[model samples]
Target: MHRDTGRDVVVPEGLLRIEDCLDATGGIALPPGVTLISLIERNIANVGDTVAYRYLDFSGPTGGHAVEMTWNALGVRMRAIGAHVQRHAARGDRVAVLAPQGLEYVAGFFAAVKAGMIAVPLFAPELPGHAERLDVALRDARPAAVLTTSAARQAVDDFLAAMSTADRPAVIVIDDIPDTAAHDFDPVNIDVDDVSHLQYTGGATRAPVGVEITHRAVGTNLLQMILSIDLLDRNTHGVSWLPLYHDMGLSMIGFPAVYGGHSTLMSPTAFVRRPSRWIEALSAGSRTGRVVTAAPNFAYEWTAARGVPADGSGIDLRNVVMIIGSEPVSIDAIRSFNAAFAPFNLPRTAFKPSYGLAEATLFVSTIAPDAEAGVVHLDRQGLTDGRATPVPADHPQAVAHVSCGHVARSQWCVIVDENGDELQDGGVGEIWLQGDNIGRGYWGRPEETETTFHGRLGRTSTSGSHAAGAEADRTWLRTGDLGFYLDGELYVTGRIADQVCVDGRCHYPQDIEATVADASPIVRRGYVAAFTVDGDARVVVVAERAAGTARVDRAAAIEAIKAAVMRHHTIAVADVRVVPAGAIPRTTSGKLARRACRADYLRGTFG
Candidate 1:
C-alpha cells in the first residue's frame, strides 16, 4: 500500500498500523457487530488512499499491464455496483457474479454482499472444461441477476440462454457502473449473520452443493487465517493467482482489507500460462511488504518443475509465506518445491500447510508460518485399523502425512467415530469442527445441511486441549475428512466419503492411488483413481497414461500397477484399467474425481 492512498476519508498516523488496533488484551480483536462491508468502511476511514488492490493483466499490447485501485476507489466502486444491482434485484435475492478475475469481479462481489443480497461468486462462461459446474451452480443458485463485465457479456448471455432456469436474471456490466452512482447508493444495514454469499463446494464428488457463508464467517475466519499465518508480523501484502471464486482465493481480498494493506492479483489463467509470473509478482509486491500467497499442492509442484529459472536471477522468496491447503498436502511436493528454490533464499518454513473446507468457511488450522511443516510417518496397518501409530520415515508401510497444525484459539476440533462419539488423539475418525467460522449450512438442501452442519459432541469428550473448549453436547460441523491428531497437531488422511472398504477393513484410496502412481513413469501423477467396481463390489484402479506416450504395452502397465498396489497394500486389485491421458475424471478444482471415474467405468464410458 502507498503511504498516501488518494483520500475519501484521511486517517491520522496513530491509526495507520494494524498493530495499533490491538485490544486491551494486547491481542487482535475484530470490532463487535461489524460486517465485511463495514470493516471495509472502517479501513477506508483509516487509510482510504492506500492502494488496496492491483491486478496484473496478462493480455495487453506490452504483454502485461498493471491496474491499481486505492481504498477510496475500491469503496466508491463497490458502492456504485451495489446501487446498480439493487435497482435490478431485491435485498436478500441471489446475485451471481460471473465476471473475469480482476478488480471488476472483486468490486461486484463486495457490492452484492453490501447490497444485502446473497452473492454467488463464479467464473465467466468460457473457462475451459467446467461447464457442468457452471450449469449446476447457476441452476441451483437461480440468481436474480448475473454480475459480469462487458468483456464477458455475450458469453454470459449465451450461457444463460442454454439454461432451463425459472427466470432470466438481469445482466449488468459491472465495469460500466460509474463511481458517481455511489451518491445514490443505499447503505444496507447488514447483520453479521446475514447470508453474504453462497460459496459452492469444489466438486471432488458429483452434484455440487453451495455452502452458506455469512459476513461474520468471512470476517472471523480471515482473522483466524491471518493470525495462524502471522500475516501482520510486518506491513504485509497478499499476492495470489488462485481463482477468487474459490474460498482460499478470497483471501486476496480479505487479507489486505483486514490489514489496510495492498494485494496484487492476477487471473489464475495468467499464472497457469506462465508460473514464473507468480515468482515475479512475489518479487514485485515485496515493495509493499512481506507477501503471503496460497495454493494447492500441485501448483507448488508444477511451478517448481516447470516455472523456476535456472539462474538464481531476480527472485527472492525470503519474505514469502505460502499457505498450502484446500486439498490433501503432499509432503514430497512441498519438500521438492522448497529444495528447488533453495538457491533463491526461499525459507524452509515458507510453505505452511493448512486444512480447511467451504463448510468451515475455508480456514480450520495451519502450521504457523514460522515453523517447518510437521510430517509424521504412520504405520499403514495401524492407520487403516484406526490408530495413528508413528513409524520410522523409511518404513516401507509408513504413510507420510503432513500435519495441518494445532487447533487455533477460539476454534475447536474433536475427532469422532461414525456414531459421533469422541475419539482420543491417535484414533482416526471424522473431524468435527466447532467455531464461529463454521458456515450456517448448505444453501437449500435442508436434510444434508442439517446432518452436515449440526453435529453434537459425544458424552465422553474430555481429555485433550480441544475437550474443555468443546462443550458437552455442543454442535460441530462434521468435516467428513478422516484424520487423527498426534502431539497436538492434526494430520488429515483422506475423505471419508472417498474411502473404499475391502473385506470389512476401510482403505483410503489415496494410499492405493499413491502406490499406483509410482508403479511406472507411464502413469500420470495425480491422475490415478482407486475405487470399487461392483456396477460395484470389487476394487478397481483406473489411471491415466502420460500424454504423448505413443507406443506402449497397456497390459504390462496395468499389471505393473496391480502388482505394486498388492505389494504395498496387500490388497489384490479386482481390476486395473490404463486409459488414455485425460480420460480419467477430475473435479473443476483439479482433484481426481474418483467416484465420478468409478461411475464412468461402470457405465463402460472408459471403453
Candidate 2:
C-alpha cells in the first residue's frame, strides 16, 4: 500500500503499482546527513573522475563544446573559490554570483556554500537586460561579495559602478582564482540548521524576495524530490536548459549531484533558440540510462511547436521522464507534447507534472514517475463554487486540469476557506503548506514573513482541537494560490491575486488569456495577461502582438479578444490593449507577470 502524505490517505491503485515496482527494484534511499558539500566530498572520494557537470558552452573558441568537470576537479576549484570568499567574508555572509552560465557559476555557488556563506545566484546584469533586477536583488541581499567569470567581470564592474562605493560588494572573478589557493583553504563545517542559500522567488507580482533555505530544508526537499521522481533503483541522467539563478534550475543541478547522478547543462538561450536541442539532449542521455529533466509548461509547448520530424532523427524517448514544473502545469501543453513526440517513441508515461515554489526549497509533490498524467475535465461553473465537479471530456463548459499528484511524503498541505477553516477534498480554497521543506521565511522582511509564512487554520479539527492558533502561531505557509484535491491529487486552479471577478462571476486569468490567444491570429501566444482593477468589476486584457504585426489593426484585434472571452468565459471585457511584442512583462522563468502588467496599465505605461 502507498503511504499517505501526512494523514491517512488511501493509496491510489496507480501509485500502489508504482510502490510494487519500488519494492521489486529496491527503492532508492536518501543518504543520511547529506549536504551539497558533503555530497561533493563523497563523490570526490568515490567517483572522482565521474562527470559531475557538463556545460554546453556555445561561445568558446571551439564554438559549442562541452566544458566537463569531474567531481574531483570541481572539488578543487570549489575549494579555491571558497578560500578566496572566506578570506573576504565571514560565515553567513551573502555572496552574490553574477557569472555566465557555465562551470564557473556552479563552482562559485558551491564555493560560497562551502565557505559557510549564503549563496545568491543571479543573472549577470549585462546579459538579458537584468540590470534592474540585479540592482534590486543586490540592494536587498546586501551581499558582501560578488562572484563572476573573467568574461563577465566587466559587466559586473559596470553594474557595481552605479551603486554607492561604501555599499558595493567586492567582486571576485572565479576564473582568476589560483589553483594553489585551494591548498590553503580550511573548510567550514555546515550545521543542518544553518542557512544554506537565499533563493529569490520569481518576481511575478513585485520585487523578488529572497527565501532563506536552510541546510536541513535543502536536504529534506532533495529527498522529497528523489522519492517523488523515483530516482532510486535507476541510472538517472539529466538534460536541463533552466537558468542557474532560479531554484528550479539549481534543483536540477543540485539534486542530481546529491543523488550521485550526472546532468548535462545548457544555457536557457540554447533551448529558446532551438527547442529541438532539449529533445536531442534527452535522446542522447536516454541511450545509456533513464533520463530525467524538468522545465516550465511553456518550454513543452514551444518544443511541440517546433514540429520535429516524426522520422525521429535517431531520437528515442521511451526511457525519458520529463518533470514539468516552475509554473502552473498545463494539461493542454502536456497532451500536445505527448502527441507531438509520440511518433518519435516518447512514452505516454514520460510527462510528470509537479508543483512547488522557492519557499519550499524547490519540489513539493509530483505525479508518480511511471504513470501518465491524470487529467479531469471540470465544469467552469463548479470551479466558481469552489467544487471540482468532473464533467465529460466533450462537455461544453469543460476545462481540463492535470493532477500535480499528492503532497510530498515529507510535506503536508491543507486547503482552507477564506475564514481559514479546513476544507475537505473537492473544496477549492487557498493552499496552505507545512513541512520541514518550508523555508525559514522571506529574508529581511519580517512583516511579510509573518504574513506569508505564518498562516493558521481556523476552527477545530475532527478531534475538537484547534488546528492552529496561539499554541501553533501560524505554522502553515499561506501559499497565495488556489487549488483543490480529488482522489488525493492536488489540482492548482490559479493564483488568488490574479483571479478575475466580473459581474459577480469568478474567472481564472489563465483561462481567459488562453481563450484570447486562441481567439485572434495577430495577438501573440504566451504573451497575454488578464486581470481586474481593484474597484472595477469587469475584465481587462493586455496582449502582445506577434512580431511583424505592426500593420495589423489593433482595434480589430481587441474586438476579437473581447468577443472570444465573452463567448468562452461568457464575461464582458472592460477593455483590451494590444501592444507590440516584448511590451508585456514576464518573470525570469517566462511566466506572464499579470500584476505587473496591471500596474503598467494603470500607470499608462502601455500607452
Candidate 3:
C-alpha cells in the first residue's frame, strides 16, 4: 500500500476484474465485470499510492485543515462500510447515504456500489431548505438501509421518526463500523446494466424524480467527461464544494479517482460563507499542474465578488479548467469570473461553459479546455420566434447566450420540433440526446420513463459529425431543455415548461427576470421569477425586494418590474408582487423556484 500503516487485508478472490474490458492503454471501454470500487483497488496497487481524496475541514479547532485519505485507506473504508451495509441491506436493495459532505459521504457511496446495492445519494437532515426533498426521495426510493455518521444520527432519527415503522430503514452508523469488518467484505457479481444509484432531480418545474442511473451509465459518463476535459492526466487534481448528492457533484467526487488524480473537497456551507476558501483550494491543488473542478453559475459570481484576493496574492489558476453549467449559462458571470481571476494568472480560456442534466447522467457537452467560452448575441424577438438570429451587441433587442459546447465524444445531439422532426441549424427547439450515459429512466414510473427516455426521430437528424447516420430505432433522451445548434455548439435556452407564451410568442423567463432586476436596485439580483398565471394568458412577475428595503417602496418596485418587462419583452404584466427576501423559494442547486412560487401564488399564500 502506498501509505501503509501496516493494516492490510488479503485481496478477495471473488472480486471482479475489469482489466480485460479496457484497452491496453486503460483509457476507454467499460464492461460489467467490475465496479468502480474494484478498479480503485487495482489502480492504487498497480500504480503507487497517493492521496486519493482530501477533505478541507473548516469546522475544526485549527480554523481549517485538510484531512487526507490515501487510495489504500479509502479502499479499506469502502470495504469496511460495504461489509457492514451488506449485513443490513440485501443485494440490489436501495441504500441511502445521509451523511454530511466529507470522506464519510464518499466512502458510503462507493461501499453501497461494492455491496451490490442501489445507492441513493442524499443529504443529512440538517441541511436546511431540503428537508422536504429528503423525505420525498426516501419515500420514493424506499431504501432498505440508510448510512449516516454518528454526529448526524440523532437528526437522522428525528427525520425517520416522522415515517411509520415499516417505512423507516435500517440506520448504519458508518463511523462506528470497525475497520476489521473489511475482512468480511464479499464483492458481489454486479452487471453493467444493474441499477447503481438514484439521482434525484432538483424540482424546478415539478416534484423531484429519481432517475435510475445504471453502472454502465456512470462509467460511460465518467469516461466521456474525463476525455472531453483532457482530464486523463495521472496528476489531475479535483477541487470542489458542491453537494455530493447532486448530479454534477456526484460525478466530481470520483472524477479524479478514475484517473490517478486526487480530490480536494469542503462543505458547500464553507464555500458559501467564505468563497475564498474555494479559490484557496484551487491554488493549493494547482501544484499538480492539471487541476479540474466544477461549479454552478452563482458560485462563480460569488467567488469573483468576494473570493478573489485583493492583491492576487497566492492563487495561480494557470492550469485550472473549471466547468460552469447551470440551466442557462450566464455569459456575464463567466466574463466577471475570468476578469476577476485574470490577475492571478487565470487564463481567459480556463472556464468551460457546458450543458448537462441528471437524465443524461450529468454530462452532455462542454467546451474544449483550449477554447474560450462560446457566446453569441442574438435578437430577443428572433429567439422568441423559434429562430436564433444574430444582432449587434448594442442593439436594443440583443440578448446573449453562452454555448454549452458541442456534444461530447461519442454522444449524439439533435434539435427537434414538437413533432419529433429534426430542425435546421438556426431552428430553436427541444434538444434531444442519444448516448450511453443516459439513465435508464425515472424510477418506478414506467409510463413517464417511456415518454421521457423513449423517443424516435421522425426523420434523419444530422449535425456536423454528430448525430449522423441516426438509426430509426435509437432511443433518445427528451431533455426538456430548449436550445439550438450554432457552429457545432449547443446553446440551451430554457426549460420547455419554464417558457411563457402570450399572443403566440414564446419567451424565456430568465430574460424577463434579468430585466426586472435591472429595472431597479430594489429587486434582488438573481431573485426574480417570471411566470404566466390565469391560464397562460396573463403574465405574472414575483420579485424579491432587496434586503433592508423599506416597505413603502414595494409599489414603486412592482411598477418598475412591470414597466421594464413591457418595454424589453413587450408583454403586459397581469400581476406584479414585490415580496420580502427569501419569501421566494429556490431549488437546492440555487435556482429560482418559480413553480413553487406559482403554487403559493395560486393558493393565495403570499400576502
Candidate 4:
C-alpha cells in the first residue's frame, strides 16, 4: 500500500516485510579493499571541484550570506590540517572537535580520519555542567589536542586552566590555525579495522563510554545505506539541521552525502531555534531537485504546530523524504505532520521512520524510500505484560506504534529473549544485531567493550533457542532497545533501561506518555515522562495548559490524572506538572532527552 500527495509518494508495503524484501545476498557485500577515508578520496578524485558542503551562518537572520566548499578545496584544507596534526599527534591518538556544524567541522573530522586519529566531537555547551562534561570526556578520551572555534576558545582555556598540566590536553583554536606553510607530510596509513571515531554517549560523568567506530565498519554501513536506501541515485541534494555531534547528523546525513558525492546544505541552529527553516531549506532544494533530510519525531511535530510560512506562494514538500529518527519513533507525530502539511503536498509516506545507533555507524533499519509509513497496533496490556500481542487498530486496548522498517543492507538483526534466545515473530525482546558494520567497541574501556560488544550472544536462527556454543565465536552488539518483529519489520517499543515496573507490569515511558496525553488534552503528549522516584514508579506529565484559562491547579490536576490512569490501566500517577509551553528538554533532533530532563528536575532547573 502507498499514499500519494501530488508530487509526494509513500510506499508502506515496501517496509512492512523487510526480511523478504532483499535478495539472497542479504544486502551484505564484501567491498574489495575499501575504507571510509578511501571513499572520500575517491569522491575527491572524481568530483574534486564539485561543491560538497554549503552552510548558512546563523548570525544572519535572512540567511542569504553563506559559505561553500568544493571537494577539491576540502581535500586541500584537509591535507593541510592533517599535516599539522601529524606533527603533533600520532596514529590512534584522539583529536577532539568542539565546534558547531559547518565546513570547518567537516574538514576537521575528515582531517582527523586522514591522520588516523580518532575524532571526538562534543556538543556545544548549553548549561553550567557543559564544561564539566567536556572535562570528563577529555580525561576519558585522553586526547592529544582539542579543536574549537575562536568563540569557544575561552571556555576551553578556562577548562584547561583548572586542570593540572599533566591532565590537560593541548587546545588548538580552529580559526587560529594558519594555512599550511612549507611542511609536506603524508597522510597516516590507516588500517580499515583501525578505530575511526569515538562518539561519546550522553552520560559523560557516568563512566564515559565512547562507541569506537572503525573506518571499514563505517564505510560498509555507508555503502549499505547508499545501496539499500538508494540514496545515491534518488537524492540530488541533501539538507540537515541536526547537530554534528550526533550519529544521525554525522554519519547518516553527512557521511552519506560525502560518499554519494551530492551537494549538502547545513545549518547548526536553524532547526533548534526555528524548525521552519528546515522546511524552508527543503523547499529551496526542491527548486533544484528532490532533497532528502532527517530529524527526530518532535521536529515534525514542531513544524506542524508552527506552520511553515506560505509567503503568498506555495512551497511543495512532495520531493522531501524527512527521515524521522535518532530517537523513539512517534506515530502520532507522523500522522499529525502528514495531516498538517497535506495541502503542501507532504506525502504520508515521506516521514520515513528509521532506527540506528552510534555503535552501528548510524545507518540500520530504514523505511524503504517511498514506502507507505509502517505501523503496528499492539495490545497495550499485553505489551506491558512482556508479551507482544497484535491488536486491531480500532480496539480499545490497542496502542499504535510505527515500525523502524527493516535492517539495512549488510546487517542482520534479531529480537532475543533475556536468556539470549531468539524470540519468535511478534515476541518482544532486546534487539541484538551482528554485521561487519558494527563498531569495534567502546574506546579505552575494555570491560565495557566486553560487556556491550564482545560478550553479547548471537542467535542461530530467527526462532531458535540461545546456543551457548555460538556465543563465544560470534560478536553481537546489544542495542539496549526493547522491540519485536512483525512480518519481518522491526517495531521498537521502548528502551530496555527505560522500562519501569509498576504494579507487577512493565510500563514503557513512551506508552505512559501516550496514555497520559490521551487522557487529557492539557497534558503535553510526548513531553510526559514516567520513571521511578525512590521506591515507587511515578508518572510526571509536563504540559502547556490553554491560555486565558485558570492556572493549572497542580493538586487537582495530579489527582485527576491519577484517577484517569487508574481507571484506564490500573496505574497510578505520582505527579503532574503543567508548565509553560516549551519547558521540556529535547535533543537537537527533537527527541525528548528524558535522562537530561530527570537530571534537570533533580537539580531544580525545571519548575
Q: Per-residue alpha-carbon lDDT of model 1 for 343-456, expressed as tens digits? A: 887888888899988888888889866799878888999989999998999998898899899766567888888888888889998998987788999988999988989987
Which prediction has the highest lDDT against the true structure? 3
1-607 per-residue lDDT for model 3 (tens digits): 2322333422333222334435665434675344455456555565436777899999875689889888777778888999988888998899999999999999899889878899999999999887988899999999999999999999999999999998889999989998999888876766778888999999999999999998778878888887788776767788899999999888887675566567889999899989999998898878657788898898999898889897837778888888998889998899899889889988888888889999999988998768998789999989988999988889999999998886776678889999988898878999888877899999989999999999887765554434684444778999999999887778999999999899888899999989998998788787888998878989988887786667546678778778988999999999988887788888887778889889888888777
User: Model 2 misses residue 593 by how many Å?
Assistant: 1.1
Estimate every model's Cα lDDT from 0 to 1.
0.82, 0.81, 0.84, 0.69
Backbone clash pairs for candidate 3 read: none
TM-score of every prediction relative to native: 0.94, 0.91, 0.94, 0.88
- How many times do residue backbones clash in model 3? 0
lDDT value, candidate 3, whole model: 0.84
Cα lDDT of candidate 2 equals 0.81
lDDT of 2 by residue, 78-156 (tens): 8889889988899899999998788899999999998889999898876664566778889999999999998888888
What TM-score does model 2 achieve against the real structure? 0.91
- Of 3 and 4, the candidate ahead on lDDT is 3
Q: What tens digits encode model 4's per-residue C-alpha lDDT throughout 339-359? A: 877777777667778888777
Worst 10 residues of 4 by lDDT: 7-16
Q: Which window of 10 residues has the lowest lDDT sum in candidate 2?
A: 9-18
Error of 2 at 307 (Å): 6.2
Better model by lDDT: candidate 1 vs candidate 4: 1
- Which stretches of candidate 3 lie above 4 Å from their native place? 1-28, 31-34, 461-466, 469-471, 547-552
